[model samples]
Target: MDLYITEKPSVAEALAKYFNSTGANFKKEKNCYKDTKKNIFITWAVGHLLYQNPPEAYNPEWKNWKLDTLPMIPTIFKKTPYAAKKEQYKAVISLIKDATTIINVGDPDREGQVLIDELLPANKKVKRLLLNALDETSIRKALDDIKDNKAFSGLYAAGDCRSEIDWLLGMNLTRFFSLKAREGGYTTVMSVGRVKAPTLALIVNREAEITGFKTQKYYNIFAHLKINGVTVKASFVGDRITAKSEAEKIVTASKSSELKVTDVFKKSNKQEIKELYSLDTLQIDADKYFGLSADDTLKTIQKLYESKYLSYPRSDCKYLPTSQFTDSPNLIIAFNEAQLLDVKIPLPNLRPPVFNDAKVSAHHAIVPTGKIPDLSTLSKNEKDLYLLVLKKYASIFFPVYEYESHKVILTNGKYDFTFTTKITVNSGWTALYKNMPVSDDAEHEQDNEVEISTAVKAGTAYRVETFELKDAETKPPRRYTEGSLIKAMNNIKGDTKESNNILSKIKGIGTPATRATIIKELIAGEQLSKKGKTLIPTEKGKNLIAILPEIITKADYTANMEILLDQLEAGKIPKQKIITEVTDFLNTIIKQKDSLKIVNKDFPCPTCRKGFLMIKYYKDPDTNTVIEYAKCNNAECNQITPAKNNKPKIITCPVCKKGFMISKKNSKTKNIFYACSCYPDCKTVLSEDDFNKKRG
Candidate 1:
């Protein structure tokens, strides 16, 4: 039997459809689709079914975190089936064991290559299929041109090194900081990771800047002048004045009512359409236009890709390969037939800015599959995003935007004022968006308009009607939204000179595939919160950063590690070297863990009067709800008491007005229930449904 393993079930189904299209009789089976005549079997794994073994897997003593076992380095890392995905693993194993030949049809990336390659049996002959797009044509082409699986061995090695290193660092550091914080009387789990810590630091640092910012008052001097029956507004040439008296002096110094135009520079410029959508750019555009979070936009685009409405969504490249350009006319025809194109714009003979093979990696920029989608079937957000991608793709065929820029300098006594104006000579590419809704990107909007007549010459003199001094204040830096945060993560570079050049060349912090997961993990761990579109670090997040070493919190550290991984992927470095370096780093962190100090406020233990209480959080397994508590520090007395929920909650008990409703678990059954905090005395309990209705 010939077996094909894909990274996702959707991809498997798409490939199965392609095989069956040529009159190959294929039938869906228990865990795979079978084509008996062609002797082919297609199956998929639900992402990664296998993950690195937890710390406990190395040794039972590693299960309980203690300062003595601070650095638990596994001599030999092992792989095990993910607890939640064991069934899928078993099915895949069974299929692979029985197959005579195997084809690795995973996504075209390091992670994808490792995910399937690690599971293949060494006895079976293996081939690799690299698909840039999931459309029928692309799928068929890839199927016809499969390569040896060993071609991607370097990618697998890089991925393996990354996974093992992350596990080692995350396991040791999370326990180290968590226990250290506990020693300082903090009860919450201080979760830390290689990528997550630095990402959190970004938010925390921004918040600190916002908090410590002192607004400075400033003033601007504006002069209103009339030129050829048109009023032109000009501002003082230099920086804003810090003192009101200084601004007043400038206004007073301009005693001459008539101002002469000393210089006028006019030039025509052209602006090409914005680059095509990479996952980062698409996420940014989605957030700017529709207030969609990075996670939401990724999910939507992935769905569209799986549905065959768009190409791959996790691509980092923003340029199409030369091969894809060959199909541009067909794509345009499809768009026209689907009414996605307003005007039938002919494809330019010369190559546009969007085409370049040098910029294409793994996959090309995200574009439609030329498969017309049913608009009615798509959700509102999906339709919006599809249209957004379509418009960007169509823009390359349109003309370049042409505009004439004019800069004017006016002199009033000692003060020289400057004004600028722009006139659109031709809309060109921007004409496609004439009827489209305005984007939320502030940079997309034209600057302040200054009306000027055509008759006005460079040497012409105009009368200054009035001068106004405007008071302004320097604003604090804005907080990161999900979209901007992703961009920052993608663009972040090392701060130090040692790793600056290498880190600058590589993608920042996380890969396009993992960035969404990183943000989601931070949010799930209560390290970050979303208020509208802004991502704010929580107290827990801030505290984690406070206790971590500077090296762990800097993007440079992670960027340097990423560089090593890239080197491993390119075969420039050995996998064992990366592992050895990580192990050494871990040992150093463990040795220095004792010196780190965390200052946590202490509370007297209610259960044990002799011990100071530490704040700890307990997550209920059944309900997945986290409850904070005050835990006794004494090992002998080890008593836990529920901490008060001081944060504002919408739910309050009807029976006892003084107590709020909190989620509590049944000690014996381990079932979650909502009950009044007054417990034994008031004894008011409700189910989740009842609580929701009562709150309503």
Candidate 2:
């Protein structure tokens, strides 16, 4: 019997169903999907069955993160099944023992290449089934073209190398820096990562650039010309006027002049729907349209995928399999039956170019699985995300956007002015996105163009009416919003000199699968704080980057490391070498003499500026419970409050402008209320309901 191991339950069911259609009846058993006559027993791993052994698993002494035991590098990493998933692993082993051959049906991605492959029993005949899609037809096609599992050894090594690299750096460097922080009287546990370090560095560096930007004043002369009663606004060109006097002179001189149209250029262009959403693009759009965090978007998409409304959400690839492209008509039918669209747009008799089998490197782009979901049962987040995908899916059936990009140059006796605008020929696919916060298309900004009469001749003259000189200063670089930050992460091209001329070789810091987690982790660590849509680094975040070596923090350097991983995947480098090099790098950093110093004093109170808060875990003698609290050091202000995730739950007071809000439990009601830290000086208190309702 051939035992098939899949990464998840859905794939197992799909594979079983496909075989069932081919004259075999598959029954849902306790552990494996059983088909006795067809000699197939399919089992699955719930994500990763085994995890990398912790520091203590290697040496018990290394369990505690200490400066003395720094750089505890294990030559050979060990693995153990998770305590919770041990039973599933046992059931898998039980199935494997009775099978003659095993079919590895992992998703055809880097991580998937190794996850299911790692679970197969040794010395058993193993074959690989690259099930790119869960559709029955795709599954049958994959089964017929099954190859030896050894063919994916390189891909497996790449994924394994990436995991071990993260573990090595995360364990040693996080411990090294965190221990150093602890020695310096800080409670910060620095969660470092190979990819995360560079991501944080990018945010920190961008903030610095904004801080150092110098504002420069400039003047522009705006010419308002009334041609055939249609007023068109144009800005002065050629040399920029830095002096207000020069700009005013031009405005005064051109006020009474007749503006002659020097040149008129118009070119018709067509824009089709954008390529399907890769996880990166989808995350970006979700953030832009709905202010949804990349992490939240991924979670919502995952829910949609599991609910069968969508395909794989973690896929990096955005191209669909050719078979699935041909299968799109059925999906259209399903979506229509499910009433997926707000308006019933006409489906054109055309095939989209997004379908190419060769382009589907991993799982195909996230798409509808032709399953009708109960729209009423979906959460707001789920519905919002589904709509986002639905729009893109439906867009391919619409006509291309046709527009005439027009530019007109106007000239007086001494100065020349120009204005550019687009005249819409057809609304096409863009009609779906009207009145939305659009992605940064160069022509998308309203300020980029002005409307003009399409009938105006090249040599037509008009009176220069109501011209003005506007003075403006160059603004500093804007802080990165979540959407723009994700775009930056995905677009890995750096300046040639900055990236050591390897600009074209590397793609990004983190994969689509991990970038959201990296950003969320940074925010959770209090290294980053979100103010509105923009991200600002906290003092702790700034301090950590200050002491870190250039190699760890620079994105290009990490991107180079990503290039190495790609090489590892292509069999250009050995996986052990990658691990060994990282271990050695950790050793050098741990051996450094300088100590990390943060500007913050010893637990300065987050609420009260006058006092410091000391965190302590207390044991209840009667209840035998261990609970943590932050107690103020000032004897007069002896305030004891429950610890907020090992830190004080300090919020700025809404009533009192000078003090922060501290949680106080009422002795009578046993309910929490927020009180001003200033207390008697500013006796402002609010109920817990108000506390939860207030925004920071």
Candidate 3:
């Protein structure tokens, strides 16, 4: 008899229902069921059933902060004992005790591998069922052909290596920094991990870019042409007229001369619709269109997918396999949504869903279940997300969108004017997106709409309708918006560029499941703040990175570690090798005591209300300040004020001498209290309504 254990109760229940097993018993604490004929029981563990603990567990005094315990490397890391979990742990142990055979049914990835391997008793015999998608078909197949746990020894090694590295570095470095600071008031939670540090660095780097950007000026030449009494717009190619004199000369040259059509090049092109929404891609789209954070977007999509309104949402692949193509029609039948399932889904005679097999990683791409979404029952946000999924699925059978592209070149002797236009030959899958407008923050926001003129011969001539010099400026790199950041992390851009090549080699900074959490952590840590859809680093964040060692803050270091992790998983390198490397790296960073600097800025302290505030920058021991109230630095007559706390809080107005309170929540939550910091002299105060409407 074999007992299968899954990572979550939801998945176990799903499998049970799909099999139509009778006399199944469900318990939250035990999360198990019995298979009467075989006397086998199936159970589950919430996320990770076991985890590494603090060094203090071994030596009580080790809990205390000290430089002597700088590198606390454990020969063998301890597991979170059943004694701690008490109830669930007891249930699992009992289930294991009675079982002759155990099947590990965790997610098909590193984290899942660790969850199962770490919980097993030392001498227990176990097998692994590597199931990627939590679907009935996938689950049944895995159960029938269960592989020996030994087959996945490489995967477990990688997970073990990852855990050990995080523990050695995070535990030791956090302790090293906490004890060294003068505030001696240790940070309740000062974390440093492989992904966390580099994630924070992304924000710190962006903040520097925003602060150092300097504006520059440039110019261009423009013309408004007339065709059969209708005006058509055109511009000079490239920055052909940067200087004022050059622009004026081009404008002057176009005024009198005939706009001769020196050359006309035309070509017809076609574009295949994008495949489907992977979780990352969906999150990127939501951030651009709905201003949803990556975390929020994931949550919404997960709900929709689990509710059977969409296919699997955690997929990394954007294309489906060819094997699933024929069954696509039956999958559509399960959908209850009226938008689709009602209309005949066109099934084009295309190759199997399988394309290049190498493109698939842990799972296939996200798709619809062919279930029609009931738009009326869904929230506005849910509906919007569902529609995105539905449209992408429907587009699978769509033909390529064809267009006739024209490049009409006009030369007034030396100064040339060119007109380019695209005439649509076929709408294809674009029809699915016709009702949806382009997201406001869409990438590559080029002007797609152009006035198409009648085809011109190679040597045609026409009069110049209008001409002028248009002033412009060379803009700096755009800030890191959630959409663009996701793209960067995924390395979705083309290869050939060096920076992109570097990004491609490295696994993404965080896994798909953890990326959203990482972004949330940055915001909660106050390292990054949202400026509309863009994530800009805070002043404190910049200073934090400035003080840390270069390796601690750069993406390249994280990427290199990722390479090692891959090697560990393939059995090419031992787990201990990478774990040792990370431990050594953390120790080197902690010892760089003299390389640290902290930036302090002054503000009227919110906590004390009378003194100027001194912001503490670095977390390392060398930089700590002792200032209770936000106070003025003057020794003789120190004035202090209450320092503002984190997030939305109440504050009194300094100007107008009014005793009103202000909060930092959404505009609807703002009060009328905030005023100028000039005290009674500048008696200016704005109403809550007025301030709420003010654009930051």
User: What overall lDDT goes with each candidate model?
Assistant: 0.80, 0.78, 0.65
User: Across residues 390-424, which tens digit of lDDT does each residue of candidate 2 receive?
Assistant: 88877777789988877878788688888776778
For residues 1-696, write the lDDT of model 3, one tens digit per residue.
677888877567766665554344433333576667656677888777676877987677777777666677777888675455556666777888878888888877788888877777767789987765555555566668888988887888888777777777678766654444323222333445556676767666666676688766667676676654556556676554457887787677668666777876889898886556788888888877677788888888888877877766666777765445656656544442343433445665765343333455556777766456667888878888887777677776667788887887877787677777667788777776766756775346544236454555778777776676778775656787776677666663222354345557544666677778877876776567888888887654554566556676656665666668788878788877887787778778667655543323325444345543442233335556542323344344353332333212224453444443332234685533345445455656655565444412
Judged by TM-score relative to the true structure, which candidate is superior, 2 or 3? Answer: 2
On lDDT, the leading prediction is: 1
Task: Point out the higher-scoring one by lDDT: 1 or 3.
Answer: 1
Best-to-worst order by lDDT is 1, 2, 3
Report residue 17 deviation for candidate 2 (angstroms): 2.3
- In terms of TM-score, which candidate is strongest? 2
Winner by lDDT between candidate 2 and candidate 1? 1
- Name every residue pair that clashes in candidate 2: none
Cα lDDT over the full model 1: 0.80
Q: Candidate 2: where are CA atoms >4 Å away? A: 225-231, 334-339, 342-345, 435-444, 451-455, 494-506, 556-574, 593-696
For each predicted model, how many residue pairs clash, with residues at least 3 apart or on different chains?
2, 0, 35
